[model samples]
Target: MRKAPLASLATVGVIATEDVHSNTSVQQALASSRSLRSVTAPALITPRSDGRARATRTANFVSGQTAFAPTGVRLAFSYARQSEEFPDGIRRQHEENARVAAGLGFAIPDTPEFRYSDDETSGRLKSRDAFNRMLDRIASESKPASALFIRERSRIGRWNDPRRHDYYAVYFADRGVPIVESCDPQWVDWDNDTSDEVTLRFLHSTLKSIQSRNERIEIVKRTNRGTRAHIKQGFYSLKAPYYATDRWVAWAHTREPILKLDPGVSYVREGCAIILRWATDGSVQVVRDIFGWILGGRSLGWIAAELTRKCVPPPGARYNTARVDGPWHKELVRKIARNPIYRGDLLYGRTSQRFRGQEAVLAPQAQNDAFGKILYLDFLSDPPLSRGDFEAVQERLEANLYQHEARSRTKRNYPLSGVLVCASCRRGLHGFGSAPNRVGQVRTYYRHSMTRGEGSQCPHENRYIAAAPVDSALVNIVHDALASDRLQQLVASEVTRYLDDPRQRRRAEERHACASEIRELERELGRLSEELGQCTQSHWERSLRSRKDRIVSKLEALEAVGATLAQEDARLAAIERGLAHQEAYSATLYTLYGQAPTLVQRRVHEGLIEAVHVDFASRQVLFTTRSSTLGAEACGD
Candidate 1:
């Protein structure tokens, strides 16, 4: 074996807060002291965001460029945040941010390969993303100086609960990347540094961490107090409005609605209006007629389809579907019959225990409302609607909601599928499979894939339908949806709107830059490849061969970079189109077509339709859309 000389050097990695904390006493101290500038600190590579009174931290900090130690050793960056709230979203954001940050560093002169990671844990010096990547980068090199950086101690890690102010400064100090906090140049003595000095640094970090946490507690207290007051003032505490359908919370400042209400509300409102219009003498009769049509012999889906075919408008007079319809589906029926809000009541709470590795679970409305129901049972009961009557009515309403439904659609896709259910059983209608095994010469039949388990108390499985027919049905539906002239106009309108967004414009610009870089990388790779081909190492050939090998390796890596950039550019383009055509397409599908298109159509239509609820028996699809104008034009009962 021949000895090899090390030629590659690792760069510095800065893990800082997203924003700078200008108001912090520490910050004030740094700003006021003239001597601070003489410290020969690492140049500010990525400035932090304003502390926002509590020093905000992002799971993945945004990337920026600046000078560092050794007068530009170059920098690589990554960030970490716990998955206690939104795991997947946080992870995705972290990974995306890391990639961007790494790319930014690569663009800097004399930069080394930058790596990224996002891990979930709170122990000091124990992050998988930070610690592991730090080890990987250092191991790849043979020097003690190549290392990682962090905004502050707490940002990287924390001590035990008892020693809440403590941190692991030595652990990272020993492995290089000796924890750079806020633009400070690498501490030469930090490696052989005394315990007392390190302890003092840790103490300062501890105080900062405590202050940040306290600030967060205060912010939450303030927010909750305001929310309680708002609740008392006849406004909802949660910002999501009954039908807003998009934002996590709607701000009073903007006065824009964004919350999506339960489809039950829409169904009841539509049904109520129709009942109100009928003669009081035959009002119950009308209900009976609907119930019989849905529960007795026909599937709720069939009845919903029939009503839609008869020109019935959905709740709020949006999207009348009687004239244009699909086949009846059980989900629409249950939504109408089992809705308590129609009776002027509210329900909330239930939670699913399912998981996707690190993904967090959102509590179901039924679970959250369980306690509220127990507390208000008597208070909410009407003279004729006793507690027992309420229970009975609930059962009857549910029964009325789902009279008949095909069972096979309930399996395959569970949690998500059940979310869209028939009102009676409140179980999602199983999708009928259509894809064929033409290559295998095998016949396919519909089969039940899920069940309600022992608690017929909730929803359950249904009978299967054949694959061939359902596949044909799907094709027809999609064809009809695509052919609708109104849908095309909607798409065009949305595309125009997408072109107007500032954020979209910024992303588009970035994507264009990435595309250009990819092209440049490809050209560079080709040149390198050609150079390697012409090289000879011995007889000038031997030395040339060695150089050529190195060049080829470099070229291959450059090609990889080009490939990544291309993928990123594609993702950005998809996002741009989605944001651009979001509204018009949704309105067109929901209003004119009377249903939100499937995931397939969504890709074709972009992020237009807000949601869709299918009726199995009636074949009338209920659509929830984002456009106010188109929604207003929809037919309500």
Candidate 2:
């Protein structure tokens, strides 16, 4: 057996720490050692114990030769945010970053592989194309980068949360690569041995993060103030004007029209103010017709369908190229009907977008004329609708929403509305009433809802069974089953089995768990309320109140769930009680069922029968209960 060279093993370990080119000696040693023939090449190359020492040795090893070295590579990332006020922002940022990199004695390669940039992007957002690419490149490389250069600390992120802002820096530092802020005075490398220098760097980064957040908040405040001022002066500031309205530029002081702006046209001029005016197009007539149709008792769906049929362009069609010819939706029609702008009144500040999230929260609309009134409009031209008509339309819309007018409409009665099913296709049969004959008698029949369609085909597609016979047959079957002792025993056994089921037991346990959670939340809420009431500090009070509010909301949701579970338990209990005392309950139900009116009979059928499946060819009806089925002969027409 040939002995392995100990000197070669030590050389292999040292060379592996620097680069993989030193693997030739290790291969030679492995070839010589008979016992080490089965050992893999990676087994001889283990990571160094000291990370700082390894990084230094690797850097020296790469610098001594001409081969490419990842440890010597310094990747630079630049970000630029663009807006209407700063159109040349991206170009300026690139120039400034180049200057900063030169001042720090680091040369950023002009090539795309060495340099990354996110143009026309906000640092507040997490998703950036070039930023993610740079991170992936560093992660996938066998030898990590020595440093990542940026213009300043804020270039990493101006995140609202400090934790998120520090996450990227920590990620690079953990990989033995330090982020170098060229503009930062106290910039320190990742391999810095002094604790004081590292602490100072961390403090500087934290302060920069805080400063960035404050700067963002200040910018938002200034923008909001300017927007409110502009709105108060009666300039259109929110978004595109409503349908049938055109945005026009007018002299600010004189209130004289300078020019009519076409749809989607936007420009900023020194002495000009933007205002909304009635459009001269045929769209005005369309808006008027919509109001008139709503007042004339036309449903929203019907109005949308009619507009779509006429190929009328809906609101926002001018801007949305894809949906220009799209069908009008009922909700769009409803919005048009609800807007107060058509009534010669401007409404703003109804909702507010928070700085932290994209969703808008409800804010009270401005009541005073400062922000709500239109200064340019004199109401000289005709409004979309008269004041009285507008109020009437609003009233009609409100009534429709609350379903108060639904009671006024005539309703047809169908006793077997959902109980009747076709055996052929296993689909529910709908009741259809025919016109009265000369004898003044109307015939009701139950037929498959879809006689011929894409779904399963029914053998008796054209066949229709008279509703009166089927209803009578179902009633007789239910009555007979209620009187039978065998059915009572079957129902009792099934109900007991269902009640004793593991799933049912789990449901009960879940209800108890929900109740326990609710109780715990209630106690927490009470404690928080007490703390909020006694707290002297404003910040502490605010925090306690927020906790209390969250707990209260959770309790309300749990209580709602508990109520639903209680209802289910009550329903099961009623079934158990009825089946337990079957003799008395059956007698009462059988007597009252025959004399019940259509509505009452419909309720009885839904409660007693799961489904009434009819086979027209065999002239047989199958009555399916909760746990069993009973068969009966069909009544003749």
Candidate 3:
């Protein structure tokens, strides 16, 4: 729904300065009713020749008409400096622009004549000369029609951008003032949903900025080209006359004698370049050795002092500063190693102009002009330093990068503890803290399944393997397999048999899948049972009691099947071991017959050993292997 515009509206003259221009919108619409007036405040401030301000105490009288509505008309004034037409580089003329903007504000709605306040400072708002006076009228007792008027939006906030025009618009509109643009004098409605219009305006604003910036850029380029052309023609084209500046000197040259140019700057630059070239060619090693010596034990100041004592020329024969007089100072080192111009290259225009004075005045010498007299100006490139020399310096500066990596490893408490991988899953092993055994003699180990992420993806989520039993057993097995010929033969035969089997392999895969599913289901059932026990409803709870019984039965069946397979696997493993160690089997048979062997051993017999799954709780180990060959039996434990 369209909002109804305010009916009883008043027009107040406003004086908007550059800072305010940025924060206000120029084009806007207001409800034009009979209550709305074309004129605003009458000029209360009269300009004086003594550079002092004078305000007339005369009470504003509305005498002319009483026909169109009954209320007496309120008079006001709007004043603002709108200077969007001036280019950004023309800093000196901003005062003139402000005066022109003020004059235009006075011309409109002539009843309240405005005095141009050209005393505004650039890059600042709120403290502007013209804006402060207008604010006073808006704050008066009569609350006269108030709003600062400007020629355009940008002029008020010339240095800073407005956050949102609507905020400022509503701010003054609520106080009975509305900013009106001279180009398009209308009250701005900030809440208007005009995306396309705003987009077009933004684009126009961007293009204008671009055009202004490009103009400055082109002027600089032209100036440079012209200077180079004059140099090539054997003519000196210094901006300031040589005689006028204390820094300038005139001298004549003999060899390839060209033209009039400042010899002092050129001589210093060429000498610096020669030194740089020499350093690049063969003196790079010397520089690095010097840097290392400084980094190792000597202070930069000490190095500089030593160099000065040795009568070494510093930075192209330029006298070393006191800091560089004794030891190799930082400045001297940087100049010798870091200066790009020494490598026969020239860099220019690295900084932009910024107003330094209180009034924001532009200085003429904003750009770099130090390197202007070389004979081969065309040959110069940015950082004309050689890449090889620069890289050498960088290498020396960063020599400790890998040294720190090694240091960190040595400092770690358990460097290689967690880096081991599981032979079966290939996942990284997890580490538990090391502790002393109950005997306080041997070290005991703790183990947990290595895991990553959350839930099943985490290796430890399935089951945690204890370190104590597995570490002891694995060590025993490795020792036995290596030292005992019987054990080695047994392992080799079993491994080879498992690799040859196909049906055994398929059965093993199916068993693993079933085991995983059953484990998951058991977890779910346990969770559900716990939840059911917590419920309040007795009837629903009783019904769940029957369902729990059925779930238990199903779980029991799965456990039974898993147990059968485990037993069968054990018997086959003993037979394989017996066959491998035929000579030793007679002596070991009696002990094995008393108890069921672990599943890992049984699978080892059937030659289906793929992986060993250890259960930390029961000290039981299950072997995942091929399921092809089933009819094997173990002699004993």
Candidate 4:
């Protein structure tokens, strides 16, 4: 409805219902009307429920006078587009930024007419509304306000971001606005004969202002650290933000605060992510199949495709905080294969995420930055993958890497290549041509160097040998040797040289150091225990107990490592002692040879087998072992 203008209503009497629903609004309107009427008595108007409805709605004959409003007549009414503009008439300023952040200064100087207080705001930027209002009022030409007093720089703006607060004093002072800053005791006390007036006046405040900011920062860091420590005990550090409901979600119509995010900690409820009963379940089969497929030479894409086809939900689909169902991607397969959580292993400090300026980014974790660094750990759920199996899968994954020399490498693929030696020249034979096949569709031969080049036909006797026959002979020889006590003797004789090897010596020294450290820790723990016994107060004793718990955790880890090393050292010492018996030594060799890699096979052959010769005409093979000087054994086919 179009209502008469407030100015026009002053002249015309109108009846309007009083807006009784809002007493404050009606009171304000009435007060404004009174204010306007005091300037010029145009008409008698009573406020209605709507403004209580239009002011001029009521028309009355009073003393038979016709009233016409003048332009100068004031109205106590406000409008949507235009409103009264006046300051509350106070000229006080507050260094409220530091006051909130550091609680450095609460009392403002006694000089200002009024103060602007920015309670509980961050000092990262000039984000205080009160600060802005103060400036606007100070800048207005009507008041032409000139001076402001601050307890200190930190109380006004962050010292780290000098640009935020430095300009107020400088910019305003140049234009006759000059902000007056009252120094705290430190600033007032800091004066010397050599100092200039400006330097002396500002030095203490400047120094203490920065100190206050630093104090605030340290407090925040300690608090964050405490929260992170709390996270270790199966509680969340960050609050349940409204937008981050996925990260910290409560189930529909539930009392749970959020998801059980602590790794290893289990909470089974009707909620996604938070319901953490991830033991031997469907996830086990899925994870096992994923890893098995990867190990079985299936590509990531193939794994993903097959899993999806089988109606398997990917890791994140069911367990992710958001509980959003989706199709599997190759990356999901890769990460699942790589995640150490399934293997019951914990790793930290690989990467960290934080806000840098306005953007959230992932960067390499801290390089010894004590304050900013954080560690994350995972606790094993149940039925974790065996360490050996996990390591073997990782080995296979690493070996699958395609590199410049990967294809050329034959040690792993062909175990006996570097092990076999040419009987005629006593030189290492190179396997060439087509790969060795017993069916003979393609021929592969271990040929000596003289047989390859276009040289004068000066031949070494039996320079070329069929690779399949040699390989077949080699496998049979290994099996036969391992079946007897001779292999054990060979292994012990070989390992005896390694007893004093540098690497072994270093490991022994490390074990010794570990033992020493454990002793020292034990002694320190005893001292702490003694101190703890003397502690009486509940809080003090609690703190001591926490310290002891942390020390105990560290001690337990050290003990585990120490025990493992001791077992290893004892085993190696027994192997050294058993080298005296040929049968025992051979048994040791047999165990080692069974577990050894292809490169170790080469070493084994080089140390024990000396040479292998095959005569196709005689259909016989001669083998010489380093067992003894009279160690030649020949087999005829």
Candidate 5:
């Protein structure tokens, strides 16, 4: 909001590398000239003696209206919303901090972090992307950060778990990086574990956590209560209609469910009662037919196939076209047969969130109650089927549910789910087809599915190859790469790391000693053989033969020891390489995928390789990255 010259305060030599939220290029930044302490940079700092090589605490921390922090101190701000719609408050707070940092001659490298966050996100979530990055930076030895700046402790986090709050504040500060929230009065230096300070910080953290949780709970409860109130007035807010587009007609209301402070003025309630009768619609006809078929001893699959043959659109097709596929799945048929909407009751508040993003499941009692699960008292519309008929259909459906589950469980599963994609359309290739049960042979291929149930098929041509061929091809590629000279170079560059780690370094040294001893024994055995050849005298020949046998036996034992040591040597080399590329890449291909099982190999390919595109018409497969389209090859071989 305001610009100020940064030549006034002389304190910290802060370098905002990239974004505060970024966890990349940390090791390079530690070794590179981009750090604030480098002579090439405008800032300068004398490193402290307490293990950390930058930012001493002797700098002027506070001066009247402005606060000038030491070199390598970072500020983290959690934005609060004044209005749910507009998040101008957090932006203004962040800008104000930057302006202050700028005027103090400190760098607050504006990396456009959280430039467009407010609309899509809220502060309640513990897993803030930027917050995680800040924590990662603080924890890193390569990225030397001495202190974290926050507007308030609650701004940093407001988890229901008090342990999480204390861990961030006390544990991190004890390790050297203290959280500084200048605006909040309750902020305590939890690093100084005094009875008074500990009590204050703990109490403050607990209260803030509890208050935030209670507020969120209240909001959810109020929303649910309002929805239920509306449902009672004949307009169902949660459950969808079975045969009709909307079960309760939305535009009918009996009375307002609120009390006005100004005698008789308040917002009017939306709807009152549902008078519409479900006589005959496509959805109604399907449900009626499904129940008839189930009673007549036809399977759910048979009913679904009959519906598909008749070209009838499945229920919820008008609402969600993407989810409704080419053929009717039995699950859809079961949902229609079991819906309470067909019997005129409107369901509300029947489910609660166990965890975020999970489909809210029915309460334990509701789920356990096989025959008496209908709990909602609100009757919104006239019944299509009698309650007795609905109960009978449900009883038969439940009796047959186990058989459906057994068939699904007995079906074969392919391991390469996450690996390949259609090169042309970039759609994932699904594995279909299975060998005969008694064939005793595995035969499956990953192909782009064009069937009705699979989400969006490729508009252009698609290609897929046999899974066995790709499995063989990938293993060969990985083995060759591991044996290449590139692997040796990677091992060499990371050897200097973890030098101070005495225990682990000692383990590496022992492996090295074992290799040296093996070489020395081999040289001794060579010399002994020459001595045995030179023994021409009959008296010396017997003694020489016995001595040579002893040497040969000892040499065999040493060689076996060296073989075991080789495995340890490889593991140690991998540890060194693992430290360097832990964030960027994975372990060596030999250790990871070369000797891995099919499931593990497929998972690695899915998680690592960004995309696999295939085209059947052109008979080509293309391997592409997250950013670009790369090499292409024919599908035949």
Candidate 6:
């Protein structure tokens, strides 16, 4: 290649010299040939055909290069919490980021790919579309960015935890890309290993994070104070009132009505308060009908179905027209029946707002006379239900709850009801009992839950299995395990391990706390009952009675919880004692198994078996015990 290119150059030079000694026409020809050579000489010695020559040339060119230096690439991210703050907030931050990048001698790509903005999104949240996309790009890109620009460190996040806010900075810094706050005067030099500079940068970041956290906390405190004040002034602070109730804006001090707000209208002037009133529409009649039906012994599901059948609009239909045709649910009926607003009373603070990680949640708070915060307002000329009727409704609801619990307890009668699962679809097998035949023998069978449903999804052809054999197999397994010494040791170790578990300790602590609350509530209830007996005024008597009733309700709930915990502890103790004296315990268990009711047998199965997966095709039954360490064993039917 070298010889060929050298020979071509020599030939061109010889032609040019010969032409110089010729006539004018020859000189003109030589000039034209020289122009051609100037155009094609570089192409003739091209490096495209040889890799080695190209590398050598590149090294030489780089060695001699001196004019230009490469600049760092800058990426920008902007975020705003509200839609109204966007465009202005996002645009200003981006422009400031570009100016800062230019000042730092960094090149910001003009394309939108390098700029990320999460408009109308909270920085305190963990998931944001644009923010996550930017992070993904940085992680997956072949060439990493030298710097990431934001209006301030808080633009990255205002996390509740200060350490969470610092995580982004540390993450970028560790990846060799330092986050640069455009608003900050002192930029961190992440590449430098100077201890003092690093310490200063770390201190600055920590201070900013703490400042952001303090500001957020202050905002939350101010909001909570305002909300409490608003509630105390007898203004509705929660979501729109229940169905048939209308919200009217009134002067805070005078209680003078300003206007009746339309559905979904939430705006209220600074000096105005929101008052709940009964609507003049037919919905008030519907509310009365619902309460009457509940008092008339109609079930909630039955009422919901009747309302849906009659094409009556459900709750929230006024706010959202789409819900006009939506079917009424039992839960909607339940809320209406349970709400005190129907009886011309306003109740607030039944639940408190809390934050779980980045998400805001509302947790139910225990209700007492002090924290329950009941306000009596004349919302309707004639309320839907009288106070006596409301109390009756509450009693009926409590009865319904107890009935529901009883029904649930007796719902599954077979010993293997919950334990048996279909291997094909992994669905629990539901138990069905056939009518007694001439011999007065009732046959029970287990069937897949989805096998006979309208839109059945289980593909297994053989879906039904006799429950008697499955129950017998489970009972035999339990008996065999009780007799085996190895199983006894395993059960002892498992029981000991479970008793020492942190979760069990937490449960015990919760039970203790629950019992303490129960005692406090009982004292409160006695005080209220005394007040009720002494009260001369009818209104005061009614209030005291209501308070007493609420305390009683709370006591019942807590007592129920304590009883459950006690039962669990007793069961564990019995198991431990039984394991210590196996002979008597085995005999007792055998006698109980032979004579126990279906409900007791079901409970015994639940205590011992984790799951029983049945495969019809392979004709195998897999029994998984409660002790996970023992693993599973297969047995033929």
By summed lDDT, the worst window of 10 consecutive residues in model 5 runs over 1-10
Model 3 agreement with the true structure over 1-637: per-residue lDDT tens digits: 1222342232222221111132333222222335434433232343457654433211111122111122433333445353222333233333333343243232223433333333323323546665666556555555444334554544444333343344455566566556554454433233432434445644654554455445545555676775555344333443322111112222323123223333133322221111111223223444554555644654344455555555444443323255332333456664454433344332232122331222311122222232233332222223323566655554554444344344444422221123333434545445444223355332323343433212233333323444555544443433333344554455567766874578666766766876886897788788779979798999888877877787788888877777776775676676556565655643353245224344434433334333445433344644343333222221100
Better of 3 and 5 by TM-score: 5
lDDT string, candidate 4, 1-637, tens digits: 2222233222222222233332333222222343244222222234355444322222221212221224321111000100112132122123332232122111223222234555445554455666666666555553322234454455555535444454655555443333433343111111111224336446644565567567667666776665545334333334221111123334634425464343323333443223223433366667777778777877676676666656665555434645343557787777666666566533332223442223211123333223343333333335346767777777766755532144334332344454555444455556654432455344566655432212232244325666676667666666566545555555665787788788988988888998898899898899889989898899988988898898899899999999999898999988777766666544565688868987787776666576666444464556666654225464523
Structural similarity to truth (TM-score) of each candidate = 0.29, 0.48, 0.26, 0.26, 0.40, 0.45
Once fitted onto the true fold, the runs of candidate 2 whose alpha carbons sit more than 4 angstroms away are 1-78, 83-85, 94-164, 171-193, 259-266, 298-310, 353-381, 403-637
Per-residue lDDT value at 335 in model 5: 66
TM-score of 2: 0.48
Residue 352 lDDT in candidate 2: 33
Question: Poorest 10 consecutive residues of model 6 by lDDT?
Answer: 55-64
lDDT leader: 6
Residue 414's C-alpha lDDT in candidate 2? 68
Show where candidate 4 strays beyond 4 Å: 1-281, 307-323, 353-378, 401-637
Q: Which is superior by lDDT, 4 or 5? A: 5
Q: Write the per-residue lDDT of candidate 2 for residues 434-546, one digit (tens) a residue.
A: 65456646677786654221244466764677778776767676777677776667767888898888998788999999999988988888788777778999988888877
Summarize candidate 6's per-residue lDDT along 224-250 as a digit string, tens digits.
Answer: 666655655566655466688778888
- How far residue 378's Cα lies from its native spot in candidate 5, in Å, is 6.2
Residue ranges of candidate 3 with Cα displaced over 4 Å: 1-94, 104-207, 213-336, 340-637
**How far off is residue 460 in model 2, in Å?**
22
Q: In model 3, how large is the Cα lDDT of residue 40?
A: 30
Model 4 poorest ten-residue lDDT run:
75-84
How many clashing residue pairs appear in each of the predictions shown? 80, 0, 53, 31, 12, 0
Which portions of model 1 show Cα errors greater than 4 Å?
1-72, 78-179, 183-191, 239-637
